[model samples]
Target: MLFGIILAYVSVGSVLIPLVLASFNWQNRSFEIRGLSILLLTSLICDASSMLLSRYHINTMPIVNFYLFAQFVILYLLFMRKLEIKNFLRVLLVLFCILCLIDISVFQGPYVLDTFSHIVGNLILMALSLYYFYTLLKELPTTYIHRLPFVWISFAALAYYSGNFFLFLLNNYLLKEAGSIAWMLHNGLNITKNVFFAIALWQAYHNRKLST
Candidate 1:
């Protein structure tokens, strides 16, 4: 039942966000904002794929690997290139991707290493997200401060990553019920993130239309 709630929140959030953003008057017109809208849409698609894998009890290695790779690429293109702090993150993501690939290809046993790698990858992603939000808030127009997408997206990221990090660290220590609780929180975070991104995209679109 809890798992169902997790899936519903994450899946619905992913689908609704892009649609809402694209429907907005402001987003449909501007090429730049439209590009970002598309990017988020793509991310949601990848996220759905990962969720599907989880639902079917399939091996999630390929799905997770591809998702992480896509995230790294998107962050690099959209946010990392402009910032100095992202240098380490870029390197870490590249290395992490390579490691995941190698692990699936070379190692046959011992899932512990994969768990470690995932923790590191999540940590790096969280760091990048923080930096991205910080930069967005710092540079966004003062007039739009209240309207900025990062407001929700940042909080979502924080919740998602923090839960993930805690879960990973306590996996061995926590009971099965505790693990389930952590997963619920993680899914909740994802839902929040998707919803926030959608709202931001719509807001951006609206702002763009008003300007033009």
Candidate 2:
């Protein structure tokens, strides 16, 4: 838990720096930057809340639940808009939300973390990230691949989610059996995710500057 907290602070820095940068250039805020800003802010709050609740020996599942669902929506919007798959993705998002609600209400209560949703949602996100990469490859020239914000974000999402998929799948079991190891792994992966987001945001900032 201590390790998790420390990593959370570092991750928050990754998000916070870009957020501060974006704030100063309000006139140049692109949709991707705005979406990332919202995601990073929400993640910071959720991480802090989860840590505080854990410190108090309170149930932190609700915060986890909210973050998982909200992150999916935010990322979905980011990718859907970028991919121009809004109509189809919107339907899928709504259905996924309903299914998730049902799963939470029936199988997974608010007091307990929902690994099922995490696994399924992460799989979908990973697929979306891959699709984004495919689109980027097909649409962008080789020279521009490294500079595109989507490239960094997609790679980050793919790497983070793929690495954590099984960990999240077994989170509840591990939290009880190997609590220390569980938190360490979770926090470490999260830090990676945040760093990647920071990189993507920085690239977006540069992209915006070039456009202006």
Candidate 3:
């Protein structure tokens, strides 16, 4: 069940990225934005591939490597951009990444550690996401139409990631039946993400004034 949910979530994101890109093709190329989009899309693809490989009881090392690479690229692009980067936010994000790595590695032994790590990661991610949204929302009222797509995309990312984090954290307690509740959370998050992406695509096209 966990595998299935993860697979679906990634697959939906994969499809939505292209659709959103096509909708906004007229905008002047912004490497930072494009790179971010590609990073996310690639990550989703890698994630989906990993899930499929695991489900088939096949070696998933390659997929995991790809996902890690995609994550690095995303981080690189995020840091390279000359946009505003609050010191506190930067520190928090770095710590969050470190925690994620530790959670994935050292916490893989017993279910207790696994559950604790999951909860911690989810809490940190949720806090970070909320901060991001608050900042973005503050700027939205003064932005132009072309910028709305970017804002909406960020919103979608926040929602999807937050949903997954919460679901995973809750699954540890609410659904202790290994793969049962985890699967449901996985599928639920995917469905929510796809819906957000669909809305984002529509908004992008609308902003473009594209004729159907």
Candidate 4:
């Protein structure tokens, strides 16, 4: 818990740096970078809220649900820019939203985390990240992808989503058996994710500077 709290605070700092950089480099505020900034801000707020609500023994699943939905939207917007299959992504996003609503209202109660929504959303995000990579390679054969801000951002999302895929699937069992260690692992992975986000954001700032 303490570890999670500390990491959450660090994550806030990671988000703030990019946000500040974006504000100063207004000319370089591309759609992708702006979406990332908003996503990070939302994540930070949701995480902080979850932590505080948990401390007070309040249910935080609704906040998690909001985060899950926001993540899908933000990631979709991020990838749609370069993906050729824009129609497919749009349909997927619609279905994703509908399913989340149904899951919350019919399948899962508001007080508990919606495991189905989390799983589906994470899988879609992972797939989109992979698709982004595919398109990047196909479209920019001569351009070095390593220098692209969106590439780093996609890589970070891919890594984080892929790493946590199974953990979320087995969350209930893990929490039941090894609650302490499970939370520690969750927080640790989250911290790693935040570090990657910071890197991606910094890369965005640097790339924008180069372009200008």
Candidate 5:
């Protein structure tokens, strides 16, 4: 019962926290911040809708599939904007969509988790997040590293996906073994990520105010 609450409404609420935080000074935020805002908003819609649909006997896999691609695009663009990457990301996005379709339509089951597409997305985003971290470490882009918005945002993604990597890989087995403990950890991590995202939004908003 507690697990059900956490996985359902609590998880959805996590996304909403940062999203509402980001909404303040929406137009004044940088492109990177806006990208994060959009990501959180996407998450809010998908999670809430997915939960609602599930209660009504809907499949919800289609939303999950859409979310994977949309998640990739926003995060891909966010880092590309920051890391100054080139056109290759667009190519990768297209290829990823194809992979997702094939994975969903052919390989994945109706209610089974889409592990393949998730694993692929996690690896790519993790690589990008690490690369962004590498640049931050080498360049020392700001005097106060801890307060940097993207730093927090990058760390949020890194923390969530890196922790999620093995959980996702072991999800099927864990379902049979550990029960909801694995996914409970997942929901906890997701909530942590959103809290950091809210912190990042605060940093951005404060920095923007100081600048002007």
Candidate 6:
């Protein structure tokens, strides 16, 4: 419990650097950098709000649901610029929203935490991350992969979604149990994503200096 608490605290605080870096270079050419910054801010707000609400014995289910759609939209916009499949993504976005509404409104109710949306969202993001990787391999845009912001951000998405996919899958079941350890991995991966996002921001900053 102490360790989990520590991790949770770290996880919440971890986004500051990346979020600052992202905002520092807000007018960036790459949508990925700007999108990631927005995503991190969204995450910080949601996580911090959820924690505060939970402390007050308030239901945080609404926040969880909102964050689900928010990240999806953010990622969709990011991909809309990066990928060549805007039309398909538009249809997919509409369909996904419709399905999630049904999943929340009728099937599970808004207060109950639903895993179906989580499962599906992670899969969609993971697939998109993989496709981004495929483009990287095909295009070979930069010789120094370490300095590529997009590459780092893409991998960060892949790592976060893939690492937590199963955790979200099992969340409904494990959540019912007392003292479940599933959250450890969730917090750990959250930290990993934050660190990676900061690295991506640094790479973008470094690339900016190089160009200037």
How are the candidates ranked when ordered by lDDT, highest leading?
A: 6, 5, 2, 4, 1, 3
| Residue 129 displacement (Å), model 3 | 3.5
- The 10-residue segment of model 6 with minimum total lDDT is 171-180
Q: For candidate 5, lDDT tens digit of each residue in 22-101?
A: 88748664788888888888888888889889889998877877776787788888887887665787787788878878
> What's the lDDT of the predicted structure labeled candidate 3?
0.55
> Candidate 6 — what's its lDDT?
0.83
User: How big is the positional error of residue 101 in model 2, measured in Å on the Cα after superposition?
Assistant: 0.5
lDDT of 3 by residue, 62-107 (tens): 4654454354435334433423556765676577567656766675
Candidate 1 has an lDDT of 0.61
Candidate 1, superposed: residue stretches over 4 Å from native: 2-14, 23-40, 43-61, 85-90, 107-113, 133-143, 150-153, 176-179
What stretches of model 4 exceed 4 Å from their correct place?
A: 1-14, 172-176
Best by lDDT: 6
Each candidate: RMSD: 4.2, 2.6, 5.4, 2.4, 2.1, 2.1
Off by over 4 Å in 5: 109-111, 172-175
Model 2 per-residue lDDT tens digits across residues 128-150: 99988887768765586767776
The sequence of per-residue lDDT tens digits that candidate 4 reaches over residues 34-141 is: 788788779878877887898999988899878867887887788888688889888888888889889989999677778888888789889989988887767775
Candidate models: Cα lDDT each? 0.61, 0.77, 0.55, 0.75, 0.81, 0.83
lDDT per residue (tens digit) for residues 73-191 in model 6: 88767866788787998888888888898999889877866678767888988998899888888988888889988777777778988987867656656565532477778888889
Each candidate structure's TM-score, on Cα atoms with residue i matched to residue i, is 0.69, 0.86, 0.62, 0.86, 0.89, 0.91
Error of 5 at 147 (Å): 2.3
Instruction: Please give the range of 10 consecutive residues that has the lowest summed lDDT in model 1.
Output: 108-117
Clash pairs detected, candidate 4: none
Of candidates 5 and 3, the better by TM-score:
5
**Model 2 backbone overlap count:** 0
Error of 1 at 7 (Å): 4.9
4 or 5, which is superior by TM-score? 5
Mind sharing the TM-score for model 2? 0.86
Top-TM-score candidate index? 6
